[model samples]
Target: MSYRSMTLLRFCSPIVIQARHGHRMRGKAPDIAKSLKERLAPVILDEEVAKRNDIGFPYQKPPRSAEFNKRFDHLKKQRSDSSLEKAARTTKLQINLDDVKVDWFKTAGPFHIRKIAEHYGVYDDLFGKYAYFVPRVFLDIKFPLNEDTVYPVYNGNKVHPLQAKSVPEVSFEHKFALSYSQKPEENTLWTLILTNPDGHLTKENSEYVHWMVSNIPNNDISKGDQIVPYLQPIPPKGTGYHRYIFVLYKQDKKLDLSSMKVTDLKDLEKRTFSTFDFYKNHEDSITPSGLAFFQSKWDESVRDVFHKELNMKQPIFEYDFPKAYLNYQKQFPLKQPFNLYLDRYADPKDVNKRYLEERLAKTHPFEGPEKKLQFPNAHELKKNIPSWKKTEIRKERLGRGRINDAV
Candidate 1:
């Protein structure tokens, strides 16, 4: 959300007070939840704004999918040979996955937002209304942006220009008084209608990029969405932090971002990012914004630090953070370090050594195959069946037979 839009939202939010209680609005679905669903939804049209902008390459044309790859490959071939279109084609920003510096997936949370206006001397602001936080689990990927560096798709500061535009619009309100038949009633969502300050919207399919629905409540102010109050501080060595990016928008009409599915949110996020980029940098004077990428390894020590900072219990498994994290324990263990839940990837050498040791332990000398066979009841039975007894019986039977035959 842009600064100007945020200011406007803060100002107009007061008008919401006059809205009739339970008065149904015409056109759109009455359920506020419907808006909430589309708000964080993905673009799903055959052609999006990004794809239209560049006929050659469709944004997020699934690389693995045959249809996407086919189009992408065909477009690449056309661009390579078309010298006339080279300027525009080459101007687009390109990124490699390897360039990212920090890689993490965490639950979202709302932290660091000021609970009260500084002017109020730490007292909650009277007009404030909105509770917001990032989810507890999310993928936090960061791309470094350097000052004074500008790329076609990314601005300086080593960050993508698209990211800057995709910032979420945030607001607050309180609806605790609203009666609910459900035991756990839903919190009121305070929404801010935002626009592309730079006049750039999604090119092909208007992509919905960033979204965050948090449980953060506002105990400070009354009026507006009061779902999020305050962010809880996890002690250092904490469980890690999640940042919710609220990209708010007010459209002239409802959007079909979701196409009616919860899983579609991912596509919506990507589209939102792309749309923000298009609008933010339409003029080329400034850069559009979006996340670049991050390359981080699974480190137990880092996980421990997160735990300590968040005031969480120490985890038992310490070999690696991502590894132990992915290993699901039989029980839903108490606040184990985040590392305990991450998938661990270690050098092959270490794995081989462990495997051999386990093998040897299973085949130790006392438990060897030969010793077990000799000590068992089979050995006693064999000893009891005397070979000499069997031979004597056979000879006695033969002698008796010969005497009978002679008679």
Candidate 2:
């Protein structure tokens, strides 16, 4: 019977089973009928739609600063220098330097920490520039000047850029606290160094080591080894304001810097030191934690320091800043290109062999009326300077040099 039924089924018509909702049979995939490309195509999602709308970042960034500024400029309605002071007062970011707590030196939030760091140029003055490592610990500086001190900072009560008149004796002693330890046993060993970065501007301008104390078991100075005996600030005359920076590095163990100690005040080689180099030499064990700075200038005490302590005649520096060219004609607009020349215009110094050998020579003819300045633009050079402006500007002071650079 089964053999007869199979022969009958082969001769009969094939019966098709209709799947529900026009779907194919369970064994077949709907995409099997489509082309290979359609089957392999990626599915577009919400994220993809967002990407097509240029909503997210690009895969490759070509321009950084330019593109970033352009993209964010529309959002920057309240610029720092906006004349409309109340334009976005609600969104304005301001910090009160006076509100800093002394305990914040030991425990402060990141925002407060950054404010403190920027206020004192923690990175700029010491680390050379913004760097990977900025000292979290800060040295609490106390300079008993004639009128002001660096202690108990309050009400923007930090040390002023220029301290009142004071001699070397006022700064001979430095008070440093490694830890605000309530007990002596809780205190940690620390290394403190003070250096003046004003001698020469090339090597660092390298820091002139003023004072260094190492291997202090606690805040006590007498317990520490005086690596470089404390020398009072004696900035040479003519040198502008000098910054005396104090950096406290956390010591893992007591350092043996007795061999590097400087007993001779006249020894310039040992005195001219590099804080960064010293840090690098022992960086693995020490991390800079504290930073503070104060400005010092030449005082009469500097004379005695040079004569007695250093046993050398003090070097006098003369900063004869040339008088700036006054805009005598206030009626005229002097903010023109020719102002670069006129702004810094100064009288040429009297000298037979003044500047250029070719110019002012015996054969060099006297100035002609055509020697007048022919500036590229303006109401013309008539309103401003004539020729020899370049020569004159060279002799001008730095204040005028900025004007030249601006133009």
What are the per-residue Cα lDDT tens digits for candidate 1 across 323-387? 32344353455764333232134454555565455445546587662222332322223446566
On lDDT, the leading prediction is 2
Query: Which residue pairs overlap in candidate 2's backbone?
Result: 137-289, 137-290, 203-206, 373-386, 373-387
> Per-prediction count of colliding residue pairs?
98, 5
RMSD to truth, every model: 33.0, 25.5
Report the C-alpha lDDT of model 2 over 1-407, residue by residue, as the tens digit.
Answer: 99999999989998899877765577446655766788799877675433322111112222567657965884576454565565456666565563454434434432364466567554555554434244454444454554554333221233432342222221111233333332223557778887876674336457788888887765666777878877776677878667676767767777888777898877655687876568668877776655555666777777877787678788887668757657564435555555444334434432212333323342336552124234423322343664556434443332343323321
* Candidate 1 stretches greater than 4 Å from native: 1-171, 174-243, 249-272, 278-348, 351-407
Supply candidate 2's per-residue lDDT for 220.
Answer: 67
Q: Which candidate is the best by TM-score?
A: 2
At residue 347, give the lDDT of candidate 2. Answer: 43
